[model samples]
Target: MSDFQCHPKPKRLTWAEAACFMVTGPTAYRQLFGWPGNVVKPGEVVLIWGGAGGLGSMAIQLTRIAGAIPIAVASTDERAKFCLELGAEGVVDRTKFDHWGRLPDTTDEAGMNHFHKGARAFGKAIWEILGTRQLPKVVLEHSGQDTLPTSMYVCDNGGMVVICGGSTGYNGDVDLRHLWMRSKRLQGSHASNFREYREVIKLIDAGLLQPCLSACGTIEDVGLYHQLLHENLHPSGNMAVHINATESGSTELA
Candidate 1:
């Protein structure tokens, strides 16, 4: 085998002069609203799960900038408050919402028995949150797991669900029958490409978009990083974590 060499370390990002928003805000805008069919119109309400996290915070601001009302779903009340500051028109308290009842109880045989019941309840809750029998035209799926079920439940007839991450897990039993019958579309999105990224940058430069960066930490502190991820003490309601490396040590960007 040939000898291998490690690459040089990149410069650390300092809190005093870092542009954390530059990365997430534009990317979120593209993922949430940049698709062909996912058009934004005035008076339209777009539901965004994980609304307080990095991508979610960006989505909220982008939605508002595009003149669409943003309905954000977050795990805590504090997150909801943060989302409002990011221009979310409405906030859903996921902690108060019944996730166990809304999602499939099992991926195996034992939980399948109650799957239909859970699916129905999930659908009803979605309808209630949307405030209409019709599905929302655009559903921005940010929390990969919790929002996946809600995506299937709430997408309006002929609407679209844009999925970005798999925080919850990939592969679940969705009621495809409903999707086909209703003509709803489920689309997956990943990190923004060059073109999309440039567009987002333009929006930021114009001051039409502002994404919140809530918490900041260092990558070297594996223990603290794991704890934050486990506890979900992340960007909720427009907050995001910024990991910064320093000569003294690593620090979290808040």
Candidate 2:
């Protein structure tokens, strides 16, 4: 009667699952920042600071599909290995490098000097991987806090840094002079629109974009979800927190 036979009701996904795809798939990959064509080229290395997270996991896969080498930076060795298994060409250990505030001495001329020198060294390593004396052409910023400056440091002249969330506090001091001089671009990306969303689903359905779904939890345990995220307990990759509205409870996936 109402085209029921031709168009049956589509399956509905839970909020957590939907959030996973929205952040990691084509919207972030294609529409929001217009990746592949907009961001990277074949053989170029795209450094994703939070490669093991939901959005970062998606970025790594998309970048690989787009024909670029994905260099994922993880907080630990286990996560780095996991990202490599998920298609990353290389991995950087965040723990190895010292961030701005995390410098040895909290306050002193020596500490400040060490921080500056560390920043330069970090920039140099990144540039070497990019095959130029400049930073990467495309830098995906997902770590939110500690790695923000790294994004600023590793970006090449005319490069773009796509800012998503600030898991860490957002405010910080950066060298703006280099940004202006290099003509680097800092762009903020959010969830994709309906059209892009559908495209992402298609990629998943076709098995072209396989994001790592690390963990799953029920909705009633939302507090646990936040706790895991805040504490960095969740494994690097896509972690799903499932909510059974009907049962009014949640459970973590094995």
lDDT of each: 0.64, 0.66
Error of 2 at 227 (Å): 0.5
Q: What digit string (tens of lDDT, one per residue) describes model 1 on residues 168-242?
A: 676644567778998887888777766666676566555566534444544555576566766887445222233
Per-residue C-alpha lDDT of model 2 across residues 47-147, encoded as one tens digit per residue: 78777777778878888877887777787888887788878876777677765443244357786677677777776666555566644678887555566
TM-score for each prediction?
A: 0.73, 0.78
lDDT of prediction 1: 0.64
Q: Evaluate residue 71 in candidate 1 and report its C-alpha lDDT on the 0 to 100 scale.
A: 80
Cα misplacement distance, residue 205 of candidate 1 (Å): 2.2
Q: Point out where model 1 deviates above 4 Å.
A: 1-18, 99-134, 217-223, 235-254
**Residue 11, candidate 1: C-alpha displacement in angstroms:** 19
**Least accurate 10 contiguous residues by lDDT in model 2:** 3-12
Q: Which model scores highest in lDDT?
A: 2
